[model samples]
Target: MGKIIIYEHANFRGVSREITSDISNLGRLDFNDIISSVKVIGQPWVAYEHINYSGRLMVLEEGEHNYVGRSMNDTISSLQMITEDLHNPQITLYEHPNYQGKSRVIREATNLAAGFDNDIMSSHKVQRGAWLLCEHSDGSGIQYIAREKDNLPHYSAIYLNDKLSFLRPLRPGQQLCPGGIALSSPQPCSWHPGCHPAPRGRNSNSRSPAEMGRIILYEHTNFQGLSKEFTSDIANLRDADWNDLASSAKVIGQPWVLYEHSNYGGRFLVLEEGDHSFFGTKLNNKISSLQMITEDLSNPEITLYEHANYQGKSRVVREATNLAAGHDNDIMTSHKVQRGVWLLCEHSDGSGIQYLARERENLPNYKAINFNDKLSFLRPLRAGRSY
Candidate 1:
């Protein structure tokens, strides 16, 4: 069994209470509307907004959460432990309500692919384990959690109808029991002092570097000056005292996008796995937010427009090509990145100045970045391709 330590104040301070079993209502312990921080050991746990596991929910993974996020802080009224094996989780999504219409069985994390991608799902059925559905491909925006269920007839009841774009199973934590009451052999707990002994099993921090994803930002160019390493998304670097301070960076596993404004707004740059000594003139000391791309990049697509604002002639490009060979050289002034990241180069051999564009709506004017009428070679960036 797992354990949860709820705190009365942020950063795990003040009065604390340890729980090793399900609690339908915190009011019974006089802890309702007062939990501010928490630390989880062993299996992952779920916190609910109302008693009896009803209303809003947040999954608490292993490790300490100094603050339980704005939406869940001081609002959790119920707790439930996830004891089922999630190693091979699975779920089936339906195109219409009551399990009707087309259906797709999902067994792994994915940014919904073509045909069924976007807001097309109206219902679902979780055959095993727990799954998380997100409103955006990058796992941002609204979200919903679904556990083992034979049928979820409608999404309207959960306010997630036609809004899901990403899906991933919530993997079980270490030392989870088969059901919910069978305790595994006891082991010394190293996370907290005076806490209950932990169960012996895989360490929660044993995931591979690729799964964790890391990026180090440096204040000065050439990997000099102040620096900080991050393993998760930062909607606003200002909160970490690092806004507009990164002149160079190093991506260890997955690619990351740096935004010019907070909350993932404005122009952006995608940095693939490798060392970056400089950010160039466009983004030097100007980054304000960061987001990691966790989707597969095997298939890429983009549309180029002959004139600005998606007007005039256009062509879809899926692979690296010399535009001159197709009589489309030096003519593209705008483009829409339908999928994956792309590199637009000024020369046919992919030399000279280049621009990185990610999935987004039409970029109406290349002139804004001094690239108008200069396109010659273009290609989608793939994994293991150094930037």
Candidate 2:
């Protein structure tokens, strides 16, 4: 059990309340919306804006909050102990672009209106957790979900599409589902296979857990509109009235390849174990067939070669990095992204012209951008967070 002390005044003075367990509604103890300072011991806690833990949140670690700060003073309505495998509170909000100007480092969910009521956030740094940057106060209005490792240079290109007014850090694996179709059942499988359930006795009503990978195709970007789930390769999507109309896709179990022509022929893009909002450029709305990639390419990788069809000096990338440090001047004539979407850039730091690659196979040249050896940098394509 964890213990937390809340004070009515700063520096731990005034009438206070001590909590050892989760309190969904602090109002029962006459402690609603009147917190100024806090001291936590042994466990982390999450405070909410309104009673019953149903408002903007702030995760507090074991420490002393001498002053709850302006954004959250006298505004905490409820709080609860956090037992999930959450990360330590470490998020920084900025008032200007590129992490410039005034800023606030938040270790808990916060309603900007409470403390920084007049602040307009233009950038942020999320060290962990999937955070939602809400446009309006108290976690409402247009919002953008920023995952771990996301370093957005501009907020104008994402959800809310402008300054952030409020922020909330979500527990790991949390899906915001913003304006997108919600899957009835989200699979446990991902790019890295481990926790997947083993095959058990067959129960005629259900397929074996071994075939748990379910691929969903959508007619619009970000998993919107009509969708169909499949556990097997579809050589012909026309049979299901879904030919050449796929604009987005979400994958589970293993990664799958989407073919532009039926029978797994013609150009194809690989949809890995994540969501693909937009195919980008010529790859969008041109899928005719798809099939699960059984070959276990356990690691997400992209290999760039100086020669066509896997030849010459090659550089394999598994994480986002500046290629200019080592291979800046090398000519990349061919490339292969085995399990994740990658953006090939003409310059380092992903600022120059780029191309999004989501599938496997050798590209003799980047004909889309009309360049071959021009790629000087590369990074993984992230869903819902990429500009």
Candidate 3:
């Protein structure tokens, strides 16, 4: 459960109201367009600009918000607690209304690529968690909040048709249940010792959960030609007679990194859990090693270098930060991942072209990936505890 306290005046002054559940219309309580500040507790909540949870939206993570910001100040008309498990958000975007035409599934926060950007999305289906769709690559401009839905046939009804450019899951506050488990209802039995049932004989028809971190590499694009499946790290693909042979891949459960050289050296690319039809020009048939990320990601650390090959000034980061606010903006040409996985972004708000960096990796050159001197924001990926 979650709680939200709304204030009628800035800085917690004036009248206030405490909300513990969804309110479709603030007018009923005579609180419409009067809230100036807010404080959230236990979980995340969303404030909407219109009644019935419609119009523009703002996500309120657990913390005190002295002011509701310019866009949402004194304009909130509705509120709803976010009760979904945001650890592995997923959504599908349709190119045409009524769930027609081309579609793409996304499981991570992303700045839409060339073909997917520029007012191309017309409908969507949220398979897991809530998502924020924005009009700019940096997550600014007009926005729409989308929650889990079997089908949202028309974006035009909301005046957002073919107008989305960036999207991301709503991150919850860093509150863990006992033993570091994320609070999801109906907890898995594996998380509680002595609750497991007796082991049963293996069944070929049984499917393994995505958390198993399985990946399949293909020798050709679109999963054609020779292929191999991996469930663990491969220091050198050459030893398996598959060096420089991966043109495409599919990931299940956790994310994986593909390195350009043996022993996990050189440039790398992070692939999230999904089907990858192509590995792009720079990485196609160039993967020499792979690393499966299976460690805790709650605490991530990375060091950015001003110059390539780990030279020049450097900055050590342990949490999400905007480099522009410091002296490291647009100057990081190399980086070393000390722990957990991190997302490097080109904008101050964790948007724009993004790159995934994994733990125990020393990437000495950003030029090879065409991202030299362009980093502005970064944050660790919070995938929750493995069950």
Candidate 3 C-alpha lDDT tens digits along 50-113:
9998878888888899998888888999999988877788999999999899888877665563
Error of 2 at 313 (Å): 5.2
Evaluated at residue 271, the lDDT of candidate 3 is 83
Q: How high a TM-score does candidate 1 get?
A: 0.51
lDDT of 2 by residue, 51-154 (tens): 77765666676678888777778888888775444456467777778988787776655545433333477777777665657776545555555656678766
Q: What are the clash counts of all predictions, listed in order?
A: 0, 8, 2
- Which has the higher lDDT value, candidate number 2 or candidate number 3? 3
Query: Where does candidate 3 clash, by residue pair?
Result: 119-162, 210-253
Q: Where does model 3 exceed 4 Å of error?
A: 113-118, 173-387
Q: Go through the candidates in order and give each one's C-alpha lDDT.
A: 0.81, 0.68, 0.81
Candidate RMSDs in Å, in order, are: 13.6, 18.4, 17.2
lDDT of 1 by residue, 360-386 (tens): 757999998688999999988766442
Ranked by lDDT, top first:
1, 3, 2
Give the range where candidate 1 is weakest over 10 consecutive residues by summed lDDT: 176-185
